[model samples]
Target: MISLPEASLLALFLETLFYGVFFTCYWLTLGILLKKYGIQRDLLLPVATLLLCIATAHLIIDFVRALEAFVLNVDTIGADAYYSNLASPLGLAKTALYVTQPTVADSVLVWRCYVLNNRSLLVGIPGCIVLLANGAIGYYIVWCLSRTVAGTSIYTTIPGLITTFYILTMLISIVCTTHDDQDMTALISWRIWRSRRSISGGSADLLPVMIVIVEGGAIYATSVLALLLAFLTGSNGEYPAMDIGPPVVGIVFCLIILQVHFCVGNNPQPHSPSKSFTNLFGEQGEQNVGYGIEQMIEETDRSV
Candidate 1:
C-alpha cells in the first residue's frame, strides 16, 4: 500500500538486515572451504578484514539514514528527487551541484563527464551491464576450468547448478527492476527497459550484455574516478585520505575475489561427489579444510 510510516524505518532496516545475512552466509561457506583446503591460508584474514571494513561503511550509511528517520523525522531529507535527477545521464547541470569539493573538482569533473555523471549503476542501467559481463566471464571461465581439471564439461554436477543459478540470478536481478509501469520511467534507462523487456519475453538472454558493461564499470569506475580526483586535488602521487578508505577496502576485496576465482578454478565447470579442496588439492587440501570451514562459517555468522 506504500503506506508505511516514514518514521518506522522498516524497509531501511530490513534491507540492511537482509544483506547482512546474505553477506555472512556467502563468506562463511567460503571460509569453511578455504580452511579445509589450506590454500592461501594467510589470505583468510585479509579477506575478512576488507569485508568487515566495507561492511562497516555500509553500516554507517544505513544507520545514519535510519537515525534520521527515527530522530530528525526525516525519511530522505527531501533529497530523493534531487538524487534521482543527479543519477540521470541527461541531467548534467543538476548533477554538477553535488561536487563542491575544490580538491576533487577536476577529477570529479572528469568522472562527471565520462563516468559518474552518467546513468550508471546508481541509476540502475549500467549496473546490469556489469552483471552480464560477470556472467559471461564467469560462465566461460567455468567452462574452461572444467575441461582442464575434469577433462569434460560435466566435471561435476554442481558447476552446472552454479552456472544455472548464476545465469538465473543475473536474469532475475535485472528483470526485477521496477523502473517502468509508473513515474519511475523518467529515471529508468535501457537496463530497466531491458529488464522489463526480458520479463515480457522481449530479449534473447533475458537481460542484455550492455547492462553488465555499465554496471561492472560503474562502481570501479567511481573508485577510479575518485582516485583520479585525489591526484587532481594534489594527492602528491599518494592516495588521498577520503579515497584510501574505499581502495584499501576494495583492493583487498579484489585480491580475495581473484584468489577465489582461481581457487575454485574453471575445472570441468564442476566436480565429483567428493568435490572440494580435498579433491582439488589432495591430502594437503584436507589438512586445513576445517580451519577454512570455520573462517567461512564465522564470516557468514558475522555477516548475518
Candidate 2:
C-alpha cells in the first residue's frame, strides 16, 4: 500500500545506487574497447557511449524530479501532490527517457543476435519487427500517460498497455539472448570438436559457456523478467525495478563488449592476424570459424 511519492523516493534511491555501478562499468568497458579496437574501428564503443549518455540523462532527470517534489515544492504542492501529477513535464520527460533507453538496448541486442547468427534474415527480421512493436507500444504508453489528469493512478489509466509493453520487453530480451547463446554455443562446440586433440584438462571447459551466457544478455533478461513479474502482481516493487532499468541496460551493454574484448585478448591467434570481435559473431563464415577454433585451442592450451 505504498503511496506514489513513497515509491518514487525509493525508486530514486535505488536508481542512484545502480547508476554509480553503471558508471564504473561504463568507464572500464570504454577503456578496454578503446585500447583493443580503438574508437574508429569498433561499433561497440559508440553504442556503449550512447547507452551511458542515455542512462546519465535518465538519472539526472530523476534527480531533478525528486528535487522538485521533495525540496523545491515541499512547502507548496508537497511531495505526494507533485509525484501524483502524472502529466507533469518532468514526468513526461522521464517517461520518454524510459521508453528511449530500452529501445536502444533492445535494438543492440537484436543486432547482436543478427550478427552472431551470421546475418540470418530469419533472426534479424523477427527481431526488427519485435523491436518496432515494442517501441511503438512504449511511446503509446507515454502518450496515454501524458493525457492523464493529476492524481490519476497509472494502473487505472493504462494497466493493459503497461503490461503488454513489459511483456514485449521480456520477449525481445529472451528471444535475442536465446539466439545469441545458441549461435555462440554452436560456434564454441564446433571449434572444440575441430581442435579436440589440442584441448586437454577441464580448466577451460566452462569458460566458453560462461562467456556465452554473459555475452548473450542473460543478466538483462533476468532483470526484465523480475520487473515484469513485479508489475503484474501490482506490487510497489515495480517502482524500483522500472527506475533501475536504464542503468541495467547500460551495464549489460558494457559487459557484453568488455567480455568479448577480454576473451579475445586472452586467446591469441599466432597463426593469423588478430580477428575483430565483430568477425567472431559470423559463425557461418569459413575464415571466422578458422580464427575462432585457433583462438579456442590457444585458450585451452594456456589453461592447461
Residue 253 miss distance in model 1 (angstroms): 12
Off by over 4 Å in 1: 1-8, 19-39, 42-45, 73-304
lDDT, candidate 1, 15-58, per-residue tens? 35544543564465355446543322444344444344444554
After superposition, candidate 2 runs with Cα above 4 Å error: 37-42, 178-207, 214-216, 264-304
Taking the tens digit of each residue's C-alpha lDDT, what string does model 2 give over 251-274? 766654455444532343333334
Global fold similarity of model 1 (TM-score)? 0.28
lDDT of 2: 0.64
Question: Candidate 1: minimum summed lDDT over ten consecutive residues — where?
Answer: 177-186
Q: Which pairs of residues collide in model 2?
A: none
Q: Find the candidate with the highest lDDT and give its number.
A: 2
